[model samples]
Target: MTDAPLSGLPLPGLPLPGPLLPGPLVDDAWLAARLDDPRLVVLDATALLPSPGHDGDYSSGSGHAQWAERHIPGSRHADLTGELSDHEAPYHFAVPAPEALAAALQRLGVRDGSEVVAYDSGGGIWAARLWWMLRAISVPAAVLDGGLQAWEAAGRPVLGEQEEPAPAAAGPLTPVPLPHAWAALPDVDAVLRGERPGTLVCALPESGFDGSAPTRYSRRGHIPGSLNLPGRGLLDEAGRFLPRAELAARVGAVLDDAASPVVLYCGGGISAAGAALALTLLGRDDVTLYDGSLEEWSADPARPLVQQG
Candidate 1:
């Protein structure tokens, strides 16, 4: 909440409070070099974005099954829907309280000074969510560029046998209160009222943006005044994020200024994280995710939505 600059913490190739470096995306070569570092922690944050009429339970998703079948050697599984969220909430992907998140990371052997690298089978969609969540809590984290696909392309080995992590000892895992990392319903309302100085970005595909696609929500349109920048487009043919200049060009069109705040939302909040990460890589740090997204927005009849087709 405070405008104070973030403390200088060393990220992979960048330091906080200074100019952002290339990105938080870690390639297989970089990860391979640090694989045996005692302070390093690898997490398979695989998850399936739910579709219309699909079961909302993340436990039933293919993420866990895939982790069981094959995963990066020594990487632990982090359940986005199960242990990382408040399942009782009305919508999915609701960010958990700091204590709850700390406990979950602790269980996965994460602690202070542990540099976390998250990867998933589905490019970095699921992994970016976990990375954003960790950074929201002020933890040093990065996403595996192109995720499992990139790892395989680099000839990295994945193990079929699961390896359990040793229990983490107690240490300082304090979470700095960063209110700007998340956007609540009131924030969206402020955006709608033109009282906020920011842009609203819809991270869903064009079908959903244009109201032509069927959805599970009560309504089938997009938030009024939102700009469409599908999460899928954040990556290229190889599933890696576009080069910095290219990323800046794509997102710069809708954003008035590089430093202006932007609120990102998708069906839930999963893909929104990808959008947020892309923005971060472009040096637009004033980004937040609308956790409830369409699930809450569309269900509210009073909320305004602009439809097309």
Candidate 2:
């Protein structure tokens, strides 16, 4: 939105084709039916969340290698690490500026009127990050239910090429910031200082939250008083989000009110989107992601962290 493409006309084309699905999580059946909508664009927003041994390894050439192996036929890839994230930022996967985001999206063949469906091989974490970014800019987008694994499991055909879509025509992409949807470093500081009213929820696994597992950040443990709700808890074995009632129940056990103000964070802010997306599906639109997350917080010795023995 900050970076609006110069032209208002639609770009000439894409190899695959939409209007998006009605909900945030579209299924194999739903996507398979409408693969030819001109206004529809499918993006494989796949990126491996960094592990202790693989921290900051996107530069080593493995990210693109995995993408080239298999993906939805005719789908374009959105690189969360290299092209899409804010490389200038100190953190590894910081969200790009509105201008940067708008430009990258245009290159990926997203028009002002395009409906986007994002999916990833790492469940939906990477996909949800893209979806959340679009939502932050007030753009309409959705995540594929269960991602590529589900599609493959259902015997769907896959394309091995890792090609990008034709550049879309320029359009007025006014990024309307959704205030409630994003929580930055300052917000987390405010929470730590007791000037903000909200719950801090770490969407990382229990080991990550408890500082018992290998970490990729500058420090171990979590923000003081944060609860552990591993992102996997929000999804089933097939990697699709859980049913609404069940989802609400699992999350509600921690924060009962659907309207409760909660700030979600995980390492580098990726898994946080998974939690944010799950909360969105449960009709809890009050949640936000700490953009810098632990990557920013832990690096500063002045910021307090809580660790378990």
**Highest TM-score model number:** 2
User: Residue-wise lDDT of candidate 1 within 42-118, one digit each (tens)?
Assistant: 99998765566522222235377788787888898898868888877887777888888888888888887777889
Off by over 4 Å in 2: 1-19, 53-62, 165-172, 257-259
Model 2 per-residue lDDT tens digits across residues 66-115: 66888887688888877788879988877888878887888788767777
Return the lDDT, model 2, position 288: 87
Name the lDDT of candidate 1: 0.80
What C-alpha lDDT, on a 0 to 100 scale, does residue 68 get in candidate 1?
A: 75
Clashing pairs in 1: none
C-alpha lDDT of all candidate models, in order: 0.80, 0.79
Candidate 2 clashes between residue pairs 3 or more apart in a chain or in different chains? 1-173, 1-175, 7-170, 18-37, 18-39, 18-40
